[model samples]
Structures are given as C-alpha cells and as structure tokens.
Target: MFGFGIYDALIIAGFLGLQFFLSARNSAYWGAIIPVLFISWLTWLLVSGEIKSILAYLLILSIGFIVLLLEWSEGRKALRNRREKELAKMRSYDMN
Candidate 1:
C-alpha cells in the first residue's frame, strides 16, 4: 500500500535508530534526533491528515520503550559481570 512507501520505510528505520540511541544512555545525540523526530512527525501529520495512522507511529514508540527496558537490564547485567570479574581477579591475586 501507498501508506508504507519508501519514505515511510525510512522513517520507520529512523524511529528504531532513535530508540537505540536514546536507550544507549547517551544524551549527546538527543539534541540532534529529538527536534528532527518531532518535526518529521508534525509534518507527516499535517500532510497525511490520517489520525488512524498515528497508532502505527505510537507502536514504534512503544517498541522504543521496550528497548529502553532491555538496555537498562543489560547495563545491570554488565555491571554485575564486571564486579564478579574484579572479585575473581582479587582472589587470584591474594592466592598468588
């Protein structure tokens, strides 16, 4: 369908990228992505005038939220792993 054209496809990719960048715990890039994303959505709304289509975009945001959760848990796991590694190293050093 025309609704899912090349432009829409690109926007979908960008939405996912934005989610990853945001969930990466990196704030430096948000300044670049936030305005662009907001304006893109605004322009798309004005041009499309299809309220029903917003649900699809919102679904992308939902996916972004899920990504954020995953990233947070991953960060916790990594931190725990690092601590365990440090403890192992300390114990080996004491044995030596």
Candidate 2:
C-alpha cells in the first residue's frame, strides 16, 4: 500500500475536498491559500516523519498536485464560460 496508513488516506481525502471547495469559491484569497496549505502540509509531514518512505511521500504529493490542477482548470473553464455568456448578453442588448 506504499506505506500509506489510514491517517494518511484520511488527510489526503480531506485536502482533496478542501481543494474542491476552494476552487468552487473562485475567490483570489481562497485560490492563494490552497497552494500554501499544500506546501505546509507536505513540509509538516517531512518534518514529523509520519511517512517513512520516500516513494509514499512522492505519491501523496503527486496525487494532491493532480487533484488541485484538475480542480483549478475546471474552475477557470467555468469562469470563462460565465464571462462569455455575459459578454454575449451585452452584445445582444447593444444590437437591440
């Protein structure tokens, strides 16, 4: 199981949920906080030696990064779509 315990799994799951929530909020402050939290958690793990294996640590980091990237891209896509819709509405009004 790559040295992952129940604790590690639960923490990762929680972070994933946090990432999703922050992405959905789409605020500048919240957007900045996720990466900081991610880094702090990893640093704490490394310092506390909770995870012994290097492979396990890397795997955890990779999973977190992938989830964060996916959620961020999705958020951006949604924002773009919303902006495009608003622009279209304004253009229609101008034409009318």
Candidate 3:
C-alpha cells in the first residue's frame, strides 16, 4: 500500500536478490536453463495460483542471463588480451 502493489514490490526485491547472487557469480550460464526453467515454474505457479511469483522469476532470470552473457564476453576479451600479450612477448624473444 505504499503507493505500489505488493506483488510489484515483491518482484522487485526478488529480482534484486537474484541479480545480486548471479552477478556475484559473474556468470549467466544458468540462463541456459531459463526457457525450460521459466516454463516449469510457470506451470507450477499457475496450478498453485501464484502468478506473480512466476512473473518475478521470469524477469529476474532474463535479466540475470543478460548480465551473465556480458560478464562472459568481458572475461573472454580480457583473456584474449592476455594471450595476445603473451604471444607478442614470445615472438619478441624468438626475434632476439
């Protein structure tokens, strides 16, 4: 009643919590499970009449997946840069 729906608040909190956990892990690899995951949760929630729960879960899952992908790309970029530096050093040594 704080000028917002309870479900909306709950969803926001849930998303924040999930984001924190997933971001801390720095991987959205779990997003790979999301399609089947959301569907399964949706089915169960529907049966239980917990519609809001599924919506919150879906939003969090989607956001978390995207963040994970971003983290992975950054990691890959960092790794590539490191390897390139190593290779350049090796080539320089060969020239010497």
- Model 2, CA-based lDDT: 0.73
**lDDT tens readout by residue for model 1, 1-96:** 135789978986676555545534434343345445555765586458744466656665566556545554554455567678999999999999
Model 2 residue runs over 4 Å out of place are: 1-30
lDDT of 1: 0.58
Q: What are the candidates' C-alpha RMSDs?
A: 6.0, 3.7, 7.3
Candidate with maximal TM-score: 2
Residue pairs clashing, model 1? none
Q: Ten-residue segment with the worst summed lDDT in candidate 3? A: 26-35
On lDDT, who's better, 2 or 3?
2
lDDT, candidate 2, 3-59, per-residue tens: 679998998777766665666564745655777778688768877887777777788
lDDT of each: 0.58, 0.73, 0.57
Q: For model 1, state the Cα shift of residue 69 in Å.
A: 1.4
Reference-based lDDT, residue 18, model 3: 49
